[model samples]
Target: MQIAKVRGTVVSTHKEASLRGAKLLLLQYIDEEGRLLPKYEVAADQVGAGVEEWVLVTRGSAARQVEGNQTRPLDALVVAIIDTVSIDNRVLYSKKDQDRK
Candidate 1:
């Protein structure tokens, strides 16, 4: 899994039948310092994360391991909405802090 920020939504008018009703989101990968990386991903949202939210994303076969998603054509999936990210007790990002800004 990697840390990523939700950039926006990806609407698909036509998709595989197995992917029906899935929420697709555009995500920009972020580094350990919270800097955005050039790489981006379109992941199926399993956590209902909104734009700008920091999320935990799992790619490849790990994404298909989730219940009810095993047959979906999902290469990536949003697994968690992060509340805080810390390293050595130094908080790098906090949802509460972001909300206050």
Candidate 2:
């Protein structure tokens, strides 16, 4: 699993049958310090994460392990919505803080 930030939503008029009802989100990789990386991925949303929320991402074959994603053609999946991220006893990012802004 990797840490990523949900950037946006993806909408497709035509797609595979297995992915018909799945929600897709655009994510940007972020380091533990909360800095965004150049890398980005479109992932199926398994946890209903919203835009700008920090999320846990599962990639490759592991993404397929998420419930309801087993037979879908998904390479990445958003598995969790993070409320806070802490490193070395310091809070790096907090949803509560962001909500105040």
Candidate 3:
């Protein structure tokens, strides 16, 4: 799994039947220090993560392991909504802090 931030939502008028009800979100890869990378991807939301929230992303075949995504044509999936991220015993990000801004 990798860390990323939800940047936006994706809406498609036409999609595969298996992905009909899935929510697709745009995400930007973030490093351990919480800096955004240039890479971006669209992922199927499995945990209902919202925009600006930090999320855990699973890619490739691993993304297909999520319960409802098994048969869907998904290469990435948001598996968790992160509340806080800590590294080297330091807190890099916290949802509460983001909410205050």
Candidate 4:
């Protein structure tokens, strides 16, 4: 899995039957320190993640299985909304930052 930031949503008027209720999103990969990394791609949203939100994504066959469909035609999928990310006791991200109230 990799950390990514949701850039935007993808709308599809027509798609395969297996992907009927799936929502696609554009994601930009990020590093452990929350820094935006090079390369960006689109993925199916398994969890409800919004633009600018940090999300956990899986790729390849693992991604397809995450959505509960082994035969899915997806290469990537957002599996979770990250609440916090820590490395060696250093907090890289906090849910508080996501709370824009």
- Candidate 2's residue-wise lDDT over 23-72, tens digit each? 88999999888799999999999888998899999989988996777888
Q: lDDT for each of the candidates? A: 0.93, 0.90, 0.90, 0.85
Highest lDDT against the true fold, candidate: 1
Over all chains combined, what TM-score does candidate 1 have?
A: 0.95
Each candidate's TM vs. the true structure?
0.95, 0.91, 0.90, 0.86
Model 2: lowest-lDDT 10 consecutive positions: 65-74
Best of the candidates, TM-score: 1
**Model 4 per-residue lDDT tens digits across residues 3-89:** 999998788878888887788899999887778888797898888899889999898887877535678799988889999998999
Candidate 1 lDDT over residue span 1-101, tens digit each: 99999999889888899988888999999999889999999999998899899999999998898888999978999999999999999999999999788
In terms of TM-score, how similar is model 2 to the real structure? 0.91
Clashing pairs in 3: none
Task: State each model's C-alpha RMSD to the native.
Answer: 0.9, 1.2, 1.3, 1.8
lDDT of 2 at 97: 98
Candidate 2, position 90, lDDT:
89
Candidate 3, residues 1-101, lDDT tens digits: the string is 89999999889988888889898999999998789999999999988888889999999998899677889999999889998988888888999999899
Candidate 3: lDDT of 73?
90
